[model samples]
Structure formats: structure tokens, C-alpha cells
Target: MTDTSTDRFDFALLQSSNERTERRNRRLLSWLLGLVLLAAASIVALVLYLQTFEREEAERQRVADGQWLERMVRFHLRRLEEDLLALAYHARERQTRQGSVTDLPAPDPLRGGTLYHQPDVLLQHGWVPWDSSAAPMAKALRADAALDPENAAALAVMQDTARGLRRPSYAGPLLDAQGQRTDRLWLSVPLFERGLFVGTYVASLSLDQALKAAVPAWFMQNHRLERVDDQVVWANDETPSPRPRDGSYYAQLELPGTQIALYVDALKTRTPWLPRLFFGVALLFLLGMLGAVLALWRDIVKRQRVERELQAQVALRQAMENAVTTGLRAWDMEGRLLYVNPSFCRLVGYSAQELVGRSAPLPYWPANQSDELELVHRELMAQGTEAQGVEVQFQHRNGYLIDVLVHEAPLRNAEGEALGWMSSVLDISERKRAERLAQQQQEQLESLGRLVVVGEVASTLAHELNQPLGALSGFANGLLNRLQGGRIGLDEMPPVVDRMAKLADKAGRIIQRVNAFARRREMTREPLELRSYLLRVLKPTQRERQVRWQWDLGRIEAWVDADPGLLEHAVRNVSSNAVEWAMRATQGSDRAPTVRVALVRSPQQQSVAEVGISVGDSGPGVSDAQREHIFSAFHSGKEGGMGMGLAICRSVIEAHHGRIEVGIDPVLGGACFILWLPLVAPVTT
Candidate 1:
């Protein structure tokens, strides 16, 4: 009985040990499987965040950019209206002069002295046809010459509005020479004099570059624009808003502060991927979670297989999510598209099925991007692997080019060698479009202002030229009469001949000045002494304004290779401007308006000498606001001037390896225009 009990005890001990060992193995297996599931879940979560949340961020950015463009356009429209008001004022003044055929009213003494000094600026090329692109007077003349009496009457009405300083806010189709009515036309404003409407001065701006700019790039981004015949005059950024109707439609809205009609584009087709991209993020996130759970369960069935399966599943899911959210596309070495996702397709206005395995389309690309596309392809194919983000153009089915920031990554298989490329296409089309359009508008505004000045100065230019000729004729006639009548003996003829020669030379010089001023200049340079030139140039400009001139430039050899004509013009222009200011200080006092000039060399630079040429008057200096951009192009502080002399002078000095700069707040009470030219030094090396 004792032996049987011992045997039973040993067997029971063995059985208990086996059951405990099996339980430990089960727990260890579960722990390993749990770790695998956790890693996979992490990867899946990252994908969900990247696709769903990040995509929303991108869309928000695009919308914000668009809204900014819209606001910009509105700003431009406001500025345009203000300019139109100025146009009206100008026209009204013209009509006042034009009305009542009695001899023109005697000019005010103060205003009359400076009236004929206005400068003429070039307006446009000869190729431009008669339309709104022409100046106010040019347009008016065209209207007066119109074949249709009704059209002429309408234009006449516009002229009256211009005369009254009102906006010319009319747009309609115009009849061309071929008798076809065309939408390409201009705005005509009527001019009014003291409640009596007189004539119309027609004015226009080029819509090609200018109109686009006035709409504002931000507005274009915010609206949808369908360019008819390659111009954006009819629509804006708001045109892209989603529409319920299946067919194309149009709506019109009156623009703020503008009588111009604004049309909204009603044409939109749902991008198959747009809806998918929107809901795909959320749905994929949930589905991905489910997939993670099922995948984890499968890993439990097999041990080593779990690592490979889980890794593969995570990679594929990440790829799919990236493709959907960030616009994934794959291309071969030959510049052919291998694959494209819904995101990329929608960006270019195409379906994935249409873009995949095709070459990059040219039509969808933004304007002027062929070279960029070609370079990208060459670089990618040459090195067998390339990754970069550069701007590219994409074509839409409707032929509009879309701007994009393209991100490319090399694709490699298990061998760890690059074969092809995968790219992320980001649509920056609206941003680029807005920026370009804004720039264009700014240029147009500048051009319009230039044209106005040019028009105002035409009469002045003719009078200015005629003065010298008249003086020469009178002097010649007097000389001829004296010689013919034998006013004295042969002895008088020498002095007479001398005076006649001087007078004739004076006329020639005046003609030369006019010719130089009228032509477009190509500044040429040669070594010129500064002291005498400054004195000679200043006399003509200052005496015209009756300003006394003083020069304190000590003996200095300021020899420099510079355009002599341009330099002389610069000195004259600045001196003239200073004299005007000085005269204004004393309220045009005949009591000697004085402008003093000083020249000094800087102490710091030895090998290079600084010739400081300054113009100082006994007048109040430039305003704080004006000082900042005193030398900037086309900026003027005074009324009825070209606003170009100082700016052009600055350009000339800088080009001659020097600079035209402002004085250090003109000491002792006057505005100063300072010019610094680098003197040519004797070679030391």
C-alpha cells in the first residue's frame, strides 16, 4: 500500500508541470502578437492623420488665397474709380475752355508763367488700333469721326461727363471698320462746365494686361474666371463656386464702387475625385482601423509570417492614403505618366482614368511652362533618380493652364535601387495667377497716369518749340533790314554779322535741346568736366523760372565717362525744380528767388572720389512723406508736371557707375537734390 501511494504522487507532479508549461507558452504567444498589432495600428493612425486632416488643411489654404485675391480686386476697382474721377475733372476743364468760342480767357499771371513748360512723354505704339486703349483726346477724336450719328452722340455725352470730373462708366460692343459689332471697346466720360454739359473726352485702358490686374489676383483665386478669347474682363474669382444645375449658367452682379458689370461663371463639372477626396479621408480612417483589427487576428494564426504581412499591409495603406490625399502620381523614365491618383487628376481637371499612364499634358500647364516640364523629365531620366519640387504647368480640358508645385520622390523596389519616380502635385495655380495679375494692373495704372501727363503737355510742347524759332526769325529780319538799308557803314557789318551768328547759334542750340528731349534716349558717356557744365546747364532752366542761381563749387577735376546730354538734362531738370520751389516759398516774389549749389568730396573713399552736386533753395524742404521715394520713378509731389525728370536723372547717374541721392535734410531751409558721381582715378596698379 505504501509503494502505490508514492507512484501516484510522482505521476500527478509530472502532469501539473506539463499543464503549467502550456499556459506560459500561450501567454508569451499572445504578448508577441499584441506588439505586432500595436506597431501596425500606429502606422495606420499616421496614415489617417496625413490623408484626412492634412488634406483639409490644403483645401483651406487654397480657399484663403482665393479670398485674398478677391479683396485685392476690389481694392483695384476702388483705385480705378478715383482715377476716373480725376479724368472727369480734366475733361471738365477742357470743355470749359472749349465752350463759348470767344477768345480764350486770359491766363492767370501766376499760372501762365509755368503753363508752357510742361513736358511730353511718349504714349503708345502705332500698331494699336483706335479704341479705349487710346488717350482721352484720341478717343474723343475717334468718336467725332465715327460713321454712325448715334454712336457719335453717345461718345459726345461721355465727353461731357469727363469734363465734369465724373467717371466714364460705359462698356458695350463697338462696330469696327468691317461693320462687325465687337465687344472690344473703351470708356467715354462726359465733361460738364458749371452745371452746363459741354463735350465728352473719351479715355480707355488696355484690358489685355491692365484689366486683368484691376480685377486683382486675389479675386481671381476667389472667383472662377472663364477667359473668352484669352481675356478676363467678363468674370472673376467667384466664378468657380459650386452650382447645382447640370448645365452652364451665368449670373451678373454689380461691382462695388463700379458701374461695370461683373459676370459669374455658372459652368462647373464635379470632379469624380473631389467628392471622393472629401469623404475618403474619414471613411478610409475607419476602414483602416477595421483592416488593422482583421490583420492582427490573422497574425495570430501564423508566427513569422506576421512581421512581413503586417509591414506590407502598413506600407500599402500608407501609400494609398498619400495617393488619395496629397495628389500622388508616378512617371516612367521616358516622360510618360505611369500612374496618377484622384487628387492629382482633380487638380488638372481630369479623371484618374484619363491621366494615368499618359504623358504630361501641355494644355493643363500654366502659361509658359514647356521648358520646365522638359527639364524635369531630362533630369529624372539622366540620373535614374531625381526628387525636387518645382513649379510646373498643367492643362485643363478647357485649355486653361494650372500652376502647380510638384514634389517628386524616387521609387525603389526591394533591391534598394531607384527605378522611376512618384510625385505629389500641389495646385498653386490660383496663387500664381493672382500675383501675375496684380503686377499687370499696377503697370497699367502707371501707364494710364503717364498717358494723362503726355496728353496735358502736348500744347505746351508745341509752344515751347515755337518760342525759339520766333525769336530767331525776328532777329534775322531786323539784321536783314539793317543791312539792306545801310544803317551805318561797312564797319557796322562785322558786329552785325557777329550778333547774327550768335542769334542763329542760339536757335540751333534750342532746336538741338528740343530734339534731344523729344526722342527716346540711349544714354552715352564720355569724360566731361563738371564745373562749367553745371553752370551752363543751370542758367537755361533757372532763368526760365526767374530764379537767381549761385554756385560755390571749388576748383575740382570731376572728370567722368558719362552721357553728357543726359547729365546736362539732369542738372537742368533738378535746378528748374528747385527754382520752382524757391519761387513758391516767396509766393512767386520777383524779389530774387535764390538757389545755391555746392560741391564737395567725401573723405572716406580715396581711390574713388565722390563728387557731391547739390541744389539748395531758400524754400521749405521736401515733406517727410515725399522724401522716402523722392528719387523713385514717376513719383511727383507737384501738380501739372511729368514727374519723370528726377527719376530719369537718378537712372542716368546710377548707370554711369554713380548715384543720384537725396541730401541729408538740406541744411538752412531748403529742399536739396544731390547727385554723386564716381570720378575716374589714375590707375595705380
Candidate 2:
């Protein structure tokens, strides 16, 4: 009985131990299954989060790209509008000058040059008269317009709008009869004459060609650009691809005085599966949490670095702005000053605090010039920019005026919207002062040169007066001797007195000629026939010298307006020099001393004709080296010459709006002098 009881106890104890082992096993399996389920749920959640992040990132990138493309398209379109406006301006100028619009030459921008790069983009461009007259070119353009009636109507509306607004206007991405968009667009720039609508400058553009021209290749690599309607449907001929609907970006391209809606579809890209696969295989949550922390830390570090770089850039820009010498100023459209740089403050002799936010008639504006400055400010606000800067005087704080050159340009934003005007002010007081000094110096030098000319001509004047005075003295002495000796009768007294009177008149005329040349006084000019004038001037020279005289005058009847006394002096000087040189050349040779005089008329195209007075002498020819300074003041080649003969002749001729030149005479084989005077209307009978 004791043995059987012990066996029962052992069996019961072994069963109890097995039951505990099975319970522990079931608990362990339950915990293992729960852990596996939790890991799977975490991985699924991470994948969903990554997909959402990727979609968000792609959408953001698309938006940014679309904005950039829209800006680029608008920029090019603005450039096109500017080119068209320039053409219109030129056409208006032509019409104003030529009184017709059809006379315009072929448009340069239409010629497929680098100015927009894409060839054959401009289909047609011409000036369309408001009257719709039957001009051949205008008629052909109208016929082309009639080919597409709907587009023509749209273009006409755009033109009317442009005329009313006095600005450029854009019309369709044209449509076909089936209501589908065609590859054509229109632009019109209005023409106005004295505020009257006269015509419009029209242009036809190929939409596809313009797109190809304006959109860059790099941007097209990742995007397909398309014109979209109100419903975001493609309006172009290109068929849509099966891209993700979520990856599209839309923007409105606001051009100058117009708007175009555009959309870009991001190209389909294969989803990368490698990272997802790696994340699944390396499924330890601790590793993922550590990676997240590391990524956050790196992102913080990157942001800090970027912030430091941005700060550095800002500091650099500030330093550059401060270092520049050209003063910078900004104004709003209302003429209110917005900003003034340090240089501008220094230039105006006022601090930035004193100038900023002030409008026209501000502190730096001269009190006397306020009205003019205000007017200029209004004009700048109206005209935006004047390429040839404005030169104005600004008063300094110390009551001195400063001359400043201000170059204005329209201030615009990234959207090409004009804000106001930005001006670059340059202090030109020193330069202006230097220019004034140079002008004064030039005037002083001119005065000194005139005085020197007078000094040089004094000797010639004395010599001229000596002969006439000596003749008068001889006549007076003879008359006195005759009267004192009682050998003169009353009848003989008349001849002697008449001779004395003529001598005195000659002396008076000589003195008058000298005074006229020396003072350079305003001349009293009259019509003088060249043939008669030449004859009169040469008679005395011929009488004084025994040289042979050849005359080529008496046929040409050219007339010149001239002061008789001054003209006679110039002619006499030239003839006298010719006679003297001819006599000298014949001294050692058997050749006869000869002087030739001629008058010829030279006609000019669309200008007053000139009359030439040529005097040739049989003397040694002028050398090339002597030609340069031959007419300069105090320059002479003869012994005992005052050197003012030719110089005085040149000055007198130039004062009469004529010129004198010297050259070798082809016929005489000697020096020749020619005086060119403007031919005038013939004297009436």
C-alpha cells in the first residue's frame, strides 16, 4: 500500500510539470505573433508616408518649374511686343515724314534671324490702314486676313482695343471652324497721329513656332508645355500622354497688356523600388529611428550652413552697394522718393534721413529751379526712362549748386511690372567746371590769336599807307613850290588840286582797308560781279608791274555778296603777290614774267554754287612741306615780308564764309592761289 501511494504522487507531480511547460510555450507563441504583426503595421505606415512625401515633393517641384517657365515665356513675349512696338514707332515716323504708311520697308524682325531664333515664326506683318483703302500691299494683307474670317475678326477687335487703350494688344491662339485651336496668333500695335487713330501695325505669329522659339530645351526635357483653355484641356495639336494627373502645374503668363494661360505636364518617371525593398529587409525599428534622428540632424546642419551663406551674400551685397560711387535713388510712380543710397546722400550733401520719403521740390532741389524740376519729374513719371540722362543743378546744404547727371530706368519686379523709377546720379560738377574752364580758355586763346594777327599785319598796313601818303606829300610839295614861285596859274591850280585830292582819297581808302581787316568788324556786303571785280583789282597791279597779264574772265557772270573794300584788299594782295613772284622768277631766265587771272563757277549738289577767283604766277611751285603751314599767321617765304599777306587774305575770305587755297598751277608751272566764294543770286537789272 505505501509503494502504490508513492507511485501515484510521482505521476501527479510529472503531469503538473508538463502542464506548466505547455502554458509557457503558448504564451511565448502569442507574444512572438504580436511582435511580428506590429512590425508589419509599422512598415506599411512608413511606406504610405514616403509615398505621400514623394507626391508632395513632386507637386512642389512642378509648381516651381511651371512658374519659372511662365516667367520665361512672358519675358520673351514682352520682348516680342517691344520689337513690334518699335516697328510701329518707326512706321509712324515714316508716315509723318512720307505722308504714307505703305512705304515702310520689309520688317527686319520677320526675317528669320537670331532675334527670336526660330525661323518662319512670323507668317505675315504689315501696316493696316484704318480707312481700308485699296493699297496693293494693304489689299493683299486684307486678303490674307479674309482667309481666316474668325481670326481676322478677332484681330480687328484686338486692334480696336489697342487703339482705344493706346497700347499693344494680343489676340488668339486662333481657332478653326471645328472650334479647335490652330497654330496661329495675332498682335496689334496701334498708330496714332496727333491723338487721331490712323492705322494699326499687325503681325501674325505661328503659335507652335513661337513656343519652340521661346521655350528652352532644358525646361522641355522634364516637362511638356501646352496652351490650356479654361477647362485645363490642351489647345494645341499635340496629343496628351498618359501622365499622372497629379503631376501637372498651371500658371498664367501675364504679358504686357495681355495674359496667356499655360500648363506643364511632368513626364512620367518609374517609381524607384530599391529603397523600399531595402527598408523592408532592414526592418529593425531602432535602426529606422536612429536614421530619422540622423536625417533631422543633417537637415538642421544644412539649414544652418545655408543661413550662414545667405547672411554672407547679404553682407557682400550691402558692402558693394556702400562701396559704389554712383548715387542710387528710387521713386514711386507718384514721384515720392522711396530709397536713397549712401552715395546719393553724399552727393546731395544731405543725409539719407533727410532725403528719403521726400517728393519733388525736396531739400536738394534748387529753390529757383523747383518748377523746372517738378516738370521734369512729372515727365519722367510719364515717360519712365530717358536714355540720355537729365542734367540738373541741385543745391547743397552749404548753398552751393551741384551739377548732377541723373540716368533713370523703370524699376520693375520679377513679373516685369513697373514699380516706379530708379535713378543713377553722377556728380558732374567737376566735369562741368572743367568744361567751362576749357571754353573760357578757348575764348581767351582766340582773342590772343586775333591780337597776334593784328600785330603781324601792322607792318603790311604801314607799307600800304606809306605809298599813298608819300604820293600825297609829293603832290602837296609840288603844289606849294609852284604857288610859292608864282609859276602856277588859276587854271593849273585846278589840275594840281585835283591830283592832290585824288592822292588824299587813295590814302583814306588804304587806311579804311587796314581798319576793316584789323578790327574784323561786321561787313556791309553787296552784290559784286566776279568778272568786273577781278578786272578792277588787277588794273592797279598791272599798272604797277610790267609783267605780262593773261585774263580768262568776261564770260562767267557769277555773283557773290561781299564787302567791296575787304574783297578788293584780298584780291589786291593775291594779285600783287602773283606779280611780284612772276617778276622775281623772270630775273635770271629769258622767260617773260606772266600773271594769269581767271574766274570760274563750280556747281554743288543741292547747295549754293561757288565762284572761284584764281591767280597764277610764273614762279617756283610751292613744295609739299610748305603747303601745311603756308596760310598760318606770320608764315612767309619771301625776304622782308611781313608774312601777313596770305594770312590776312585767308582770314578775310573765311570771315566772308569763303575759303582760300594754294597749289601748283598746271599751266603756269608755278604757284597758284584760288579764292572760293559762295555764288549768290544774280543781281536784277
Candidate 3:
């Protein structure tokens, strides 16, 4: 009976212990499953976060690409406008003296070169006269079909607008000569003569070809540029798209006469998903045994990566701030310096600690300029807007003034409230010194030019007056000899006296001309008859020397606007130079001293109704080595020469808006100097 009771009690105790142990095992299994589920959820969340980051990066790249495309479009448009302006300048320089636009010549560079005659992009380019009834001034340099009726009408409108506006105008995306669809752009630049509108210079360009020529090759590798319109498609790569979709950007630009939309498509880029995939696989492989440990390790690694990224960004910012040459600073409204970059401290010859947090009456401000700078600073602070760039001087730590251009903008907080002032300081001391040096050099050159003129006039005056004075003395002596010997009648005496009076008059005129030239007065141009002007220049030389003179003029009846005194000086200098050289040659050889003066017209293309004055000598011809430096100041080929004769002549001719060139005379077999002057209309008043 005792054994049965003990076994029952022990069985009950064993059953209760089993029940407790089973419950504890079930709870442990449930907790393990829950932890595994939580680890899976965390992994999923990390993957989603990575995907979001990639999407944001792609969007940022797209925005950057859009801005780049806009800049490219603007750059191309500016280039086109510049090319058009260059063409217009060429036309203006080559216009006719009569200001007639009936028949215009092409620029010298375009006459034979295929670049302008038949450019790949240009269909036609020529001038259109003011007369609406007349055809284009010149035939198309490039081969193309005749203009269609629609194109002609478009050209008419452009011409009229250019005439009315007195400026350049644009037209067309019209059909080509074949009447096929094409992107043809027509531009017209007005031709003006003395501020009078004369005609239009027309040009036709292929838009497709232009784009191909202008777009850079490197840009094409990463992005496909396309032209978008309502109905048509054009692209720099020649492959067109109806519209751009994902990973693409669009930029709109307004050209001379039309609007264009540019679409840039980004090339495909591989995303870095393999690393994320590998991480997930590793996490799953370690889940059961080291899940908790791996989770803690992952959190530590992520935190480290984030901190390293922040460190890298900070390093980049510091490098950027140090790399900039422009000094940067920040200040509060009360004029306390809040921050100073390394560049700013270096600029003022101070350390960051010495400058930052410094208040008004700052150490760098010069004592004498302190009040002025204070006033300017006060004005800038009171304006309540970003200040324009203001140039100011600062006293460096070395006690010397440093020129700096300061630009200030308002620094704003996250809520857009003005927090302080941000300043950019650029050291412009070198630039300012250069400008002052340039100004001083210019003034010196002007003074030197005046001195050169005075010296030339003085030398010429002495040389010129000697001839008339000697002639007069000889005439008076001869007359006295005849009168004392009673060998001449009253009639002969009258002729001798008249000759003596003329010599005196010639001497007086020489003095007057020299005085006029020496004064360096403003040039006064008047209509001068070409033939009479040449005769006056010949008179002085004829009286001085015994060289045979030959006149080779052809229908010379034109008038040119000239400073009469200076023109006479130039002609006299060149003719006398020829006479002197010719006489020198005659001393050693059998060749008779001869100087030929010719008046003729320049070539039609080279000058429009411009007259040429040629003075040739029968002397040793100029060598090629001497031709280049002959016209330069203080350069001479002759021994004992001051070398200012040709220089002075050039200055005179250029003052009259003409040009002079020296070369070997083909006709006379000697050195020749030709002066070309535009023939002006006779002054009515």
C-alpha cells in the first residue's frame, strides 16, 4: 500500500515538469521565427532605399544635362550672329565711292576660294540693290537652282524690313531650289553709305548643315541632339525622333527669325545593382546562426559609410574653397566679420584668425580712406539688395594699397530671411596697373607724333626756301650787271624785275606751308582739283633741280576731299625723294635723271572710283628687303637720312583717309610710290 501511494505522487510531479518544459520550448521557437521575419523586412527596406537613391541620382543627372543643352544652343546662336556681322562689316568696307549698290563686288577672300564661293552650307549669297525692280546684284557664287516664287516673296519681305529698320533681318524655313522640304534660313543685312541705306546683303543657309558643322563631336558621343518642331523632325545625328521620352531633356531657343527646340537623349548607363544583390545573398546565408551579430555589423558598416561620405564631402568643399582665386568673406549686418576663407586672408596679408569676427574700423582699412569706405559700406547695407561690383582700395598688412573689386550679395537662411552679407573680393591690382600704363603710353605716343610732324616741317622749310632765295639772288645780280653795263633796255629790266618778284613770292609761300604743317592743327578737308594740286607740287621741285619731268595723266578731272596743305607736303616729299635718288644714279651712270608723275585710277575691285598718284624715279630699284620697313617710323634705306620722310608722308596720306604703297615701278624700272585717294564730289558751297 505505501509503494502505490509514492508512485502516484511521483507520476504527478513528472507530468507537471514535462508540461512546463514543452511550453518554454514552444515560446523559444516563436521568438526565433519572429526575429527571422524582422531580419527579412529590414533587408527589403534597405533595397527599397537604394532604389530611391538611384532614382534621385538619375533625375539630378537629367537636370544637369538639360542646362548643358541650353548653354550649347545659346552658344551656337551667338556664333551665327557673329558670322553674319562679320559679313556685314566686309560689305561696308568695300562699298563704292558713289554709294551706288547697283553692282557690288565680293570680298577679296571670297573671289577665288571655294569656302565662300560654294560653301557646303550656303546655297546662295549676294547683294540686293535698293531698286525693288532690279534682280540680285551679283549671281550666286554657289551653284543652285533659281529662287522659287515663294522664296522670292520671302526675300522681298526681308529686304523691306532691313531697309525699314536699317539693320539686319531674317526670314525663311522655306522650300529649296528643288521645291522639296528643307530647312533653309534666309538672312539679310542692310548696306549703308554715309548713313544712307543703299541695299541688302542676302544669304541663304542650310539649317541641317549648320547644326552638323557647329555641334561638337565629344558631345555627340554621350547625347543624341534632335531638333523638334510641330510637324517636322531634324537632328544633328541625322536620325530623327518624333519626340523625346525618358532620360531625355529639352531646351527652347529663339534664333534670329525663328524658334527652335533642342532635345538631348542620354545614352544608357548600367546601374550598380550587383553589389546590392550580393549583400542580400550574404545576409540570407548568415541568417540562422549569426543573424543578430550580422545585423549589428551591418548597422555599424552603414554608419561608417555615411560618416566617410560626409568626410569626403567636407574635404571636397575645403579643396574647392582653397582652389578659387577669388577671395570670399561673410559678415553680419552690424559689420562684424563672420567668416573668411583662406583666399580672403591671403589677399589682405592676414590669417583667418586675425580677420574673422573683426568689427568696423577694420585693420585692413587705410586711415585716410576709412571714412569713404565706411560710407560706401553703409550705402550697400541700406540698399536692401545685392550690391553691384564696386571697386575699392584696401591697405594690405604691408602698408601698400591693393586694388580690389568687391561684389556683395545677401546671404539668406533656410526661411529666406537675410542673415548676413556674403562678399567676393577679386584682386585687380595688376589689371589697374596695366590700364594706367596703357594710358600713359598712349599719351606719350600722341606727343611723339606731334613732335615728329614739327621736326619734318622744320627740315623741309629750310630745304625748300633755299631754292627760291638762290634764284632771287642770281636774278638780282644779273639785272644789276646788265644795268651797270647799260646792256639792257627798260623792257628787259621789267622782265627781270618780274622774275625776281615771282621768286620772292614762291619763298613766302614755302614759309606759309611750313608754318601750317608745324602747328599740328586739326585737319580741314576741302574739294581739291587733282590736276591743279599736282602742278603746285611740281613747281617747287622744278625750281630746285634739273631732272626731266614727264606727266602721264589720263582724263584726270576728279576732285578729292583733302587737307590741301598736307597733301602738297606728301606729294612734294615723295617727288623730291625721287628726284634726289635719280640724280644720284646719273652721277655714276649714263642714265639721264628722270622723274615721272602719273595720275590714274586704281583697279576696279581694289578701289571704287579712287584715284592713284604715282611718282617714279629712274634709279636703282628698291630691293624686297627694303620694302617692308620703308614706311615705318625712323627707318631709312638712305645714308645720312633721318628716315622720317616716308613716315611723315604716310601720316599725311592716312590723315586724308588714303593709303600709300611703295614698289618697283614696272614702267620706269625704278622705285615707285603710289598714293590712292577716294574721289569726293565737288563741294557746292
TM-scores for all predictions: 0.37, 0.45, 0.37
lDDT per residue as tens, model 1, 290-332: 6765665555444334444555566666667656746777877
lDDT for position 578 in model 2: 86
lDDT of 2 by residue, 556-647 (tens): 58889999888888888888888888889889788999998888666656376788898999998689998998887667888877677787
lDDT of 3 by residue, 500-541 (tens): 999998788778766765675677787888887898768868
Return the lDDT, model 3, position 83. Answer: 59
Output the number of the lDDT-best candidate.
2
Q: Where does candidate 2 stray beyond 4 Å?
A: 1-320, 332-334, 351-353, 368-388, 409-421, 436-451, 486-529, 536-548, 554-565, 581-594, 600-611, 618-640, 654-671, 677-685
Model 1 residue 360 lDDT score:
52
Model 3: lDDT to the true structure: 0.74
Candidate 3 least-lDDT 10 residues? 8-17
